[model samples]
Target: MKFFRLIICLSIICGVGSSTYAQKNFAKEADHAFFNESYFSAIEAYKKADVKAKPAEKARINYQIGECYRLMVDPAQAETFYAKAIKLKYASTNPDVLFRMADVLKQQGNYKEAQDYYEQFLSKKPGVAEAEAGLESCKKAQVWKAEPTKHIVQNEIQLNTESYDYAPAWGDKKHETLIFSSSRPGSTGDGIDDRTGESYMDLWITTRDNKGKWGEPQILPETINTEDNEGGAYMNRKGDALYFTRCPREKKTNIGCDIFYSEPQGRSWKEATKIVLKPEGADSLSCGHPTLDRKEDYMIFASDLPGGQGGKDLWITEWDKSEKKWGTPKNLGPKINTSGDEMFPHLTDEGVLYFSSNGHVGMGGLDIFRAEETGEMQWGNVENLRYPINSSEHDYGIIFEKNSDDKRGFFTSSRPEGKGRDDLYSFNLPEIKFILEVYVKNKETQEPLAGVEITLVGSDGSQVVKTTDEEGKFIYDENGSDRYIKKETSYNIEVSKDEFLGAKSKFSTVGEENSKKYIEELFMQPASKDVVIDFPEVQYAYDKHELLVDDRINSEDSLDYLYQTLVDNPTIVIELQAHTDCRGSDKYNKALSQRRAQSCVDYLISKGIPADRMVPAGYGETTPRAPGLECETIENMATNEEKEVAHQKNRRTQFRVLSFDYKPSGSGGE
Candidate 1:
């Protein structure tokens, strides 16, 4: 009877224990599947284990199921299981669970509540860098300023869905065709994600019609798109060269997510090539999100290779045209890079840089920040792109729209009500403020002259407006204001008055200080008497006394001076004479000189000079200082240069007060 009983016990133990062993194996398999990022397989395995696992083990299995749902983007079910796990007090008390909770709250737009949980998690696990960052970001969100409602306007290019349609770059200023990355359907490949069973990300193209309307987005050519993820593209100004990022299946090859380039041939992009810039043995870690300076001589990008401060950092590389390669990459240093990731760089035409960083205080996960490119490869202090522009979620990929009418821009965000993880947004910048001032004054007294009409001229020679304010101030909109004072532009400012001399001042806006303020003084000197104008000795070609147009007196100052002198010396009779150099025939010289002298007399007569009082004569070469010494050969003279100088000295014009004494014929002759 004892032998029978012992055999029965052994049989029972073997049967029951075998069943338990099988269940344990199944549980182990489920946990392993989850750890390997096999979310679908892990979900099935965890479901099978949930029914037979112990209370504590059941809670852990349920949490794993929630993680799988989270990874698969089934946030609703993920939150359900997470809540169950928390209630069961399974190790769901960990910071990871709180982080997921905060993510769910953020998705629901309960930023205030999400921020509290994020802070709690950080307080519990102060050493977790990512958690600490998230906590600080949450606190920032509470005080962050939203963009003012009245100043911003939604642009016309609405995305198909709120999915991440951002990182927009154009090959040219026209912005007719655009290339961006999207995880939307109809990709080049239909492969399932090992993690989420979703289609892999790929590049897409969308073109704008002649009317400026965007067409449906299409996947990139198979040559550029693969089963792997392709993103962050930028094309050269000419649209001939393409640069983008490609992350293959393997991540350990140092070439993980490296930059690639291709050239356009007609309608297609040629075979893509990897850009190799690292030395031998050094890992070619991520080099992506490239931005070319206007000249294309340099590029700024982000990388996580060795020698960086920590995590990923912004870097710059000079393009060597002769070598057809990029030089060694230089780290952007602390100003741009932080202990956290700094990526997705966008530079405006004016050299303002926009990037995303979690290191700086922001509303939430990786806020968009802007910094001026203060130096060559150096950036100024980073400023957080405040409020609604950023939120308690990741915001980045800020880009200025090409040829936008409103000075608008585009950016990406993961805020709620978006189609998916991220969505594109369009916004117009605030209007820039400027002032224009003009100061007018009497030229002689330097006193501010009022009632003088001042007209500001535009580049097209059209008058922009007239200034009549008491202070002589005028304000113009940005479009018309820049034309008034921009370099390479000429403005015709005309100041006129009844009694004051009407004067026109030509000014170049180029290099003029910011105010666009122009100050000009006009002199209204008392109009004076008729006068004989004296011109400096002007030399002419040998035996040629024809007065060139330029050689004649036409300046207003000279005319005015002549008029004044005539009015002051009323009774004076003047003689106008001409002389020539001692190189030509006396008769030829005499004739030429007489003609020149007559030309001056004729001009004075036209200016109301009495022809009789102004006598004209020519002395020819006979009036040389050293009488009878004439220069024969240029070489025979002491120094050819001296001979030429002496010859020029002989050419001159002289005026004499022939007689200052005169009697008025109207009364009596004396």
Candidate 2:
């Protein structure tokens, strides 16, 4: 439900009056008030008439009361009356009650039940676009509220009241002064509005202090606030020109609301002028919720004028420099307008248009949607801002905290969590957090290795060096202060210990939109050349030198560890050695082992590693992984399985560091 920014003059088809109470004084008065848009007065009259009326009369009266509340932006009470009328079988006479009930239910965020009611209405009257759109909205809104955006929404308690208060806009370029509409107790308008039962809305202002605290609210001067509906104001980027809505006190007529313009004079604004928008003789058409583009070359406003998509459509009018007035209004087309009401259009300085609509597929009621101007006036990618920025109620009239920072702002919402029927809520998008926890451990011992030097290098040309603590844990994050890992960036994590070979892995935030915590467990091997690191899984095809590549496994991939090791420790040269079982002659086995080692060296060379960085070596089966488990000893064993195990351990692919200095050809240093 919405209040100030809501389109109140949209065509509403009232339920048929009961023949039993058609001539009665209470029922007659209620009908007259309802037809004249005095919904608050009509509801009171309808309730009194319902007290003594028959069941059929009572059903219609209750339904009418529900309609009043719905228009007045009170979904809870509207739902109550609509459910009562439906229980009395009013829906059987008028199936539109189902649609009305669904609307109110959705506004309350009971999306599943609302969809059911919408489907029921659709079955009764197939192909109703409004009902179809509502049904789709129910389903879509459920997902939006379930996985809302990063925006954190909180009711601006200092600026809200139990009465209607909404549609906040920045009153100053600095964004320190906030101007919003409130129908609280101290509004300048006197007496109750027969339409809303609250004092006619007035613009109010509150200033945020230098300490970033918002001060108490104060109403605008009398020049702007009249004994009429006045709210939903927007200021140009210059902050000098003010555009606001004004619904004059015509309780029983559809004379229509209009937009007004005012200029600031010292602490107060000058007398406002009614901005003539509609065509001549279209005085019955209502137009309000005025907003201007950043350049002030164009104005977008909500209106029920002709040539729109439907209900109330957002229209744009270009400023005519020659005529010193705005040109004829042009509809924003189906891309922006829909068959349902679209109101409260606000265009940011960045050409992003934000508005609220019941038309587009939404979470519920009036959901906030944004569109970017693609061409001269064409727009695309009309996306919902999503919940909690958009709840299952009337949410509209959004304004950012400043032109530069879009993620923080104030907007209107009639969702139940607010302090009023429609309250102003401050919203902000929290920064996405990226953290990397590096746990260094010894490869041979599998124990935590402390005091290891950790170097994090980012592709964004940022690097940070941190040492592992006594726990062998280095928490590498922004730490809520200094950020090294950032969006659209890749980082290399290098861990080096005094006696261990450096280990490196890649961690990136690129293509990742959500906050993430990386738990990287790095194992560093002892750097001594005697510590032979074996690749047992990497085997050859039964005496052939080529690396194995088959469906079961690709042994070539296992060598990537050595490939990365050579790349990480660029200055180190490695001896890629291969061994064999003593099944063949010593000379033949040595030649075969040499080819196998060269095959691995060739594979690394194809992956961009320099060939000179590796030296291939083949050792005939002279060494055994198990100290004395030689082939002759394996032959003495009783079981044939024991001999094969000894032979398999002898056949292996292993490597060792040759030197720690490997200068490139162009380097002069040796």
Candidate 3:
């Protein structure tokens, strides 16, 4: 009986082995067809293997079929196969299969379900950073609002899509004509893009008629557009000048873009000239998407210089109308930049900056963000535009429509329903709301003084309590809570620090005013000090050394303080030193420093300081308070910068009291 049972088992095993061999042959053919790009044939071969294959083998066959369908762009069919394979539980224990399922769910925009699979995959593979990033993105997507279905447009005004229209920019002045870049068939340069096989992009203009309709769009003449790619345009308020980016491709090398500007002539634009704000050796560095302030004196653009934090960063340069050139560009720094690409900067009349970035947590690829200019060359922290506007796709090139009532704007995206590549979409931004922050510091040392308390007592006797951070910074929300109606309330801010005089300041904003943004910074003083002296404000001549006659040698404010200092210390000997910024000849600067020092001494004598007790000296451009400092003198700098800041640092007067000994009237003194 045992021998008979063994013979029967052997016969059954042989039958099972024969079936597996046949199934393996079918899977091999399917994989070969898939590798050859014959996806349809691979699917048919896979179906044949599925019938004879066991549970695990069948699941593997289905996964391969799903991959082929995904590569063929049939995501729905691929999703179906992945779901079937998952149900079979062959790869339910493997993280790779779970990740594939999550990716398909994400492509379908079912973020909630995708998130579940992503979490499971991450649970199995504990240290996958990309999986974590995707999980966060899905979480954001789950809560994000859907894009608005209705367009916000004025009555009878329609967006013109007659030709290939995109990349719109507004002049500095309000209600001026709209300038855009297009690749219409009638453009002058009949050549096509080597990569896309489409017409090259060039700048175009469309004027606004009295009826508020855009007139026919026309390509800028040959002198301005050129045969190369010319886009990313900006115009001055007067419309007399224009700045744009031009990328002229050289045969095989990947030449980067540069900024150029053209002045308007009687009817047409003159020949465009290259603006060299970057150093000569760094021509390979890219600088584009420039936006000038209303005055056209300041410009902000983007560059990918080596020293930047990472990727492309924003930079600014000032226009020197006298030199007919641009000053050196300075990076906007870490506050506005991250380790991701930031581009498309747009400056508003209200000093609000609109730019796009991929660094910040966003709905997707690139999100439009806003920042306010806090100081002369500094910007506040950036805030994302947030839901409905940004999506998990490449969204960029945002610009506001001029003279529109609804605050409607246009931006580009490569989202699902677009006409191949990127398409322009219109959106209306919500009302402007912000949080105002104030920072206080010691003027002398520029160090943050903490433990300072401030009370915000409104005019209505309603108190909103707050305190400063360890860094002497305080934040106030402009839009208060729902129950607290925001109104124009005068705030009596009482500030106090240890061992220092207490001070009070007041501020109130007009109610329902949405046009302007406001910020105030205050510097406080210590209660007492041993000696106090005021320095005279210095002035300089333009490219010359002769001081103006009417100019007072000593300011009354300085003289008053000097007299008080002498009265407080009757027998004090003082020394005054003068310095000059790094400009002009070294010997000439030394002589000028000496003359300036003597001038101070003469002024002190006129104020009744004993001449015998005073010493005057000059240091010229040496002994700088801030060493190796960039941005000082306009001339003799390493870079081609017109050193405005260097000059300011150089023109200063410093004083030191040498001795303070007085003789007693009735007693002998040695």
Candidate 4:
């Protein structure tokens, strides 16, 4: 009774009625229409044959009716016929019937009943992956409904008709023009498609008004819109090339759809030519829903060709630029695809791939999911976009705005309360703005320093370079000329000027609530010789000369700063100055200080700094950090706590720049 089994069980069951001639005639007509993809005509014929059908013929007739409704995407009607077929025990060996029934129930939002049918199907056929996914989706559907996303979806009424109008694509970089496929009135051909019982689809173009309202929908020129069913339009990032689907009607069933492309001719498009992504003479196979990567070097599409995972697996092919030809098609593999259909792939500029899949565990029907490309031609961590972005209807063909950071886009959906069989809906995440304003200043004079180059590097691999304006400030926000910084991403800000020392700092928008403006001041010191900085205490155990464990550059640890400073100022040479308290013997303290200073130098050398760039000196118990402390004797200190504090200050390490020029052994210049 299931769709796949119906192909194998094509032979009709004979009727044991007195009027066998009429019963057989009606059943024969229905089978002919069904085989030719004329589900509308087949549904009518099957109903007429139902009355005269025998007990055995009844189940097959009901199952055929269910198939017609399912293909039409009418789950409510399909559920009724499938239930009847199940009650009659039609094709009891085919567990696909139970699974199909469960699928329809899920689409209708009856999760409990759908779960029951999924369990029944799984009981007979254990380890069925699709059935297991269906059960999991039912549970997730309930949870998703309870906590839906903040996306407020609106049906674009002006551009829609009382027919299938979907698969919207932005025709311009600014998204001022829109192009989509529609099977509404005034198509190229007056003929109706047997698949959907509607007029053949055609590409339509529309424009958005200055007030953000859609204008009248107009059919594209005859160059692109032909007598055949042409739709599923996708354009390259530059908007110079457009790829679409063309399903030419055949004598029997339609010659399977193939992907075709057209070049822009001024403001309009020229006649389309087939891309020939697959091997020659594979006319029976269907390919559609083309998506080109940001670089336009590779394209992914949905195809029902042979040697796929199953029905309509997503396949990719590289575009040979110099040769100007498409390479062989390759499947996306099992992680992103399944036995069920996967289509409508959209690869974002950020390398995040979004596609629609029925095989993946989702609410029901085709749900939109996104996956980050982990490596070359590899994708994982698939996540369903969740409702109300995806619904229990066929939601697909999403298109995002060019250079958009706020996640604004339009998608096609057939959910109820729409103006047509399928309508376009606009969605955008609520923009939470965070502004960063950084001011560069002189460390010694506290005067603002203008024209300082500030470079921001993000954890997401985003880098922006800017110079401080006359106000000695660089500002970044959602409305800035530069790329917007996203939330939950840490960024490192590096500031430098001609005569000033380079400075580095970091900030993050993680866990920030409400829109806030952050003001930060970065002070740069003069890059001169013998520049000393008071450093952190190198906490060594009692009488110990070795460095502590966990030697990393962090808030608590400052030893790595010695290495980083050398890296930042690559040509600069420095000396490690180590000191100790007055508690120990002078000679012993000197030995300990020397070892500590050598430890600092060794750490720097291990980090790839040349040994000649650093010099170690021990000023043990000789130069006290607290100049006011009378260190002639330990008893001369004010109190025990005061003496301990002074000693703690004295038992520290500092570095002073020796020279700004230090050449490597083979690099020549000094």
Candidate 5:
């Protein structure tokens, strides 16, 4: 069986498989085992059925075999059978073959082909949020794999076998011993799990020696590791109490899994007892993957019981000290749960929750996710650990370093790179370095401008200043031991020089997964007092003062340069002067020009620029440039096009600094 199903305690309806009849005994048995969730046995039965089946029945058998492998989490074999079933066109009864094929492909990081398959599935069934989410996950998976986080992951080959060895938990506060679940050769169970075709899982222990190498594996005593399936294990803060999932093997029975707690006593554990998370006689609903907080006041586990959003959800129940029982189980809410299975919950002592889910957008079958507590018993901000930590395979049951500041730990994965089917791995995030390299250039000449002051203001309320070198470059890597640029913060950059108009830009490190070097080149317009700067094709309506705003031209947005100038150079004040062509009356032109200048000031004020710093000056057509191109001597111009060009130039808008000493109130700048 797939680990996702097993983690939920091998849950399936007990007798549903027995009720189905088929034309062939093998076919009937295969269908029976499948509905019972015995995927491993179902695969063999279906293959046997395929030998004597007709064309249509053989196609259906192939599809059934694909379903068996898919549920067993064998994506490679599942894809093989699914591809065969698709070619056989058994799609009428198994409409999900395309989707399942895409899912398995995506689980193996074959994103491009998986995308094509997901699109094909969507073509047949439109608006399926799951398929759309899968498509989106494929897009993000490629990028995430290419630029993974600083977390380094290494397979624990010493503790692994060719079988499934995963779900490791730290057994001691010193982080030396490990208590994990495995289905290797030394398992107590004599019979194979019909679900997984492997030995029943058992809780195993291994300790670290002085050299830090894990010692040989040893099974827990009969008090914990029963002949039946034993699943994930976690320890309490004191390391005395151990909680693990146990699924008692019963022939054709729906004895769903439950969590059991055992306390260390000498060489053995006190008689293990089940933690009752379900209602009276709800044996069909599985409850496992138990985790607890530091105080052990409450326990969170995965369950498929009713009242969940869908499938398995993470549920919490506090310890009622007075009643000596767990309080009524409460769902962790839809934010942490989804319509798909959510399993293998692990909680840090500091209350950070980690779990695996296929319902949430992920790279593959099961991706590890993290959520933070928003309030008392509330959780939000569900984030994916992404890429190396969560691959295109099943990744679940992560244990931290009893962590707060420490971000390294052990987790489980069924990725192809592992030594076993599902292997334990260690992970740690290296120091993430962020370097910001800025170059200042002259806007008019495109030449590097040295001696430009670069002021960086961070969202954390940190301000730092640096000047450009002879190469017009300023590097902001760190301030002594502290990095100037940090994760999840935004920074505003102000570039200024004595003879240049101040320029402003912004850079944010939010959601950046990898260490990177950010290069920014801010061009400064040379301006002392009277320098003309052109706008980006600002268009205005005839006569009226309101600026034109459209797809092609935005007059107000064109004034943002002046807005930034005032913002970056807070001590400077400037005049926003407007002009009119010589065609209009001098009085009318003057009035219109004055209104246009005020309109610019009004727009700047809306952008949080102080009105006092910008003065409106209307020159009208009184001061036209050049002697020959003037309308007063119109005959001097060669053509009407030439004359109109000069007229358009005369009707322009520009700004000039009035004073560099006009500081705003409560400000200190020179």
Candidate 6:
């Protein structure tokens, strides 16, 4: 299996010498331990044997120590020992030693030194894939270090622990529920994976509330998790079915992993059933990391089966929806699958495919790469996502929020500063613009209204007026070349036709952290005496006649709309109407309503609207939302909540155009 291949490599390296001793030769004993994959024991024994060995044997022992440290993920130690071995001229003539030295340097973030060693190795052994890859990685790493993308990567501290937690996927409809794999404590499995040296991996879930706070993580049901390792989970679009990887323990070693899926049954999952990829029954190889396109017609997974280009190749299989089976597996070809492992495939809804690859040149281990499909089964334009998304550590398995449009996502990484061995990270491109797509329609007929004038007044004092097309649509980035909206800015939008009452709204991107395209459907009402436009409900402190400054902020939607309308219709005169709830006496409420209406008029006057073009009117409790309910009756009979609702409905402010015949002082008479 691919998981065991690394141990196998260490075991096969550094040949042991035959020697006679009443106490067995320490060098032979160390080599024996290395062959059996007891790396820690092998390192201790090798140190003891080095002091007793000859000069050449001592150098070989040092090289073995470097390999052990490299496997243990101690790049600093690996680089130190590899340098000592090189300085002592132990296996100095071999290209493998040069390659190992370069690999360790790259992992240690010494790109310049790694590049020289890789070039030397390639010169000695031309056409070596790994050497070529290492060279390319160094060059790209330098370039990325100089010019990096503006992506903010954050560690999800609340969701992580001092253990491996990674491979995040959206688990529910709202994209707020998160499902990931963790090898932390409280996992169902009691056994540990030798490859990870932690508890067996299991699927866990957490949820984000409406306030964007994440809840505590919980283990998946027993039906899906067993006394073996199970992880790399992904849910279908519906969130009803789950597909994951399962590697059961056989004796002391892990049987090769296979992909399995479970369907939800009430609150728990049904027993998992293996999705047989090949008819050959596992093939003593591993298969995991499953991903599907938006339509779920085709599936891609990582496998170490024969007839592949290299280590673990990405293979695709089509789902037979009618036959309820999968088609024959096909490799992604040389374009994607490299001599090194290419795993953790993620296909975004936008049709781009992203996967982690060691076969391709990267900063260090398994940098993420994206490929766009050029033809059927043909992926091209493979570009590395670059640092700091890719670092001198293993980073892979990215999953985006369902409809975040490539702006934000969750990915797994083993980079330093992580809470555990492998932790989940949230990443997003910080530079984003607001996208507004407006649809104009007639409020009465519910039909599209064309040729409507759409005006947008930005908080930055910039303004743009656009006409809706024949389809009553106006897309801000129609040609995908220009953008009209900006981040951290708010805009007051007004939609109007020649003979229609204007519609208004306030769209804000002020606190939005993600880039999203907002589709707003605005309706315009026909201009008539019966037409009345109401903005969002505004509240005033009890028994306060003065309009607070905070209330002005709340009324910006109404104020801006009225301001824009006045500008659009310079000759129009309007009346501001205010009403009061059935809470106070009619005499007092009527006086309060009149004061509220006067305050609205005062606000418009301060904004430079001509005072002669406006009028204020007050309707007391007699004109409540519930016309028959009186203040005293309601106060004596209704519940507190019901009274408040009734009060909210009646205590409102609205406006209506009184006349369109008012002309400016110097304008021609109408």
TM-score of each prediction: 0.56, 0.83, 0.47, 0.63, 0.66, 0.62
Local distance difference test scores for all models = 0.63, 0.83, 0.64, 0.79, 0.83, 0.77
Candidate 6 structure quality by residue, lDDT tens digits, 1-670: 1123221121112123223222447777777656544455567778889887887788888888888767656667778888888888864565577788898888767899999888878888989878987998888898997888778899999998888787787888679899888878888977444333556667899998888889999999999989776777778888877988876645434256778999999999999998888548644567787888777788898888778998888899999988998887898899998888888888877678899888887898778899998897668788999988888777888887766678788897777788876789999886676789999999878899999989989898889899999999898863256568877888998887766767777789899877789888988766565667676554566776455447345654456667777776776788888888866688998999889888888878888999988898888676765554556656775588877776678888877777767877888865
lDDT of 5 by residue, 389-429 (tens): 99998888888764425478888888998897889999888
Q: Residue 511 of model 5: what lDDT?
A: 94
Clashes of each: 10, 1, 5, 0, 2, 0
TM-score of 5: 0.66
lDDT of 2 by residue, 1-670 (tens): 2253245463222223333354567988898777766687788789889989999999999999998888877888999999999999998999999999999999888999999999999989999989998998888887777777788899888778898888888888888998888888887867776666677678999998898788999999988988776887888778899998887744234467788899999978999998888999977787888888878999998999999998899999899999988888999999999888899888887788999898898877788899988898667789989888888888888988764368888888888877877888888888888888999998899889999999999898988999998888988666456676788999999987654779888978999978999999999887677778775467788878888899987888889978878887888888898989989899988999999999999999999999999999999687776776787788897888988888888888899887777898898985
Q: What lDDT does candidate 6 reach at residue 91?
A: 44
In the range 268-355, model 1's lDDT, one tens digit per residue, is 8788998875555644355677777767888887777678878777788899999988999898888888887788887776677888
Which ranking of candidates, highest lDDT first?
A: 2, 5, 4, 6, 3, 1
In candidate 2, where is summed lDDT lowest over 10 consecutive residues? 10-19
Candidate 1: 10-residue stretch with minimal lDDT: 5-14
Instruction: List runs of model 3 lying over 4 Å from the truth.
Output: 1-134, 146-164, 320-324, 401-406, 417-421, 429-670
- lDDT, candidate 4, residue 404? 68
- Off by more than 4 A, model 5: 2-4, 12-24, 402-406, 433-670
**Candidate 4 residue lDDT tens string, 72-98:** 777889999998899899747567889
Error of 4 at 110 (Å): 1.3
True-structure lDDT of candidate 3 = 0.64
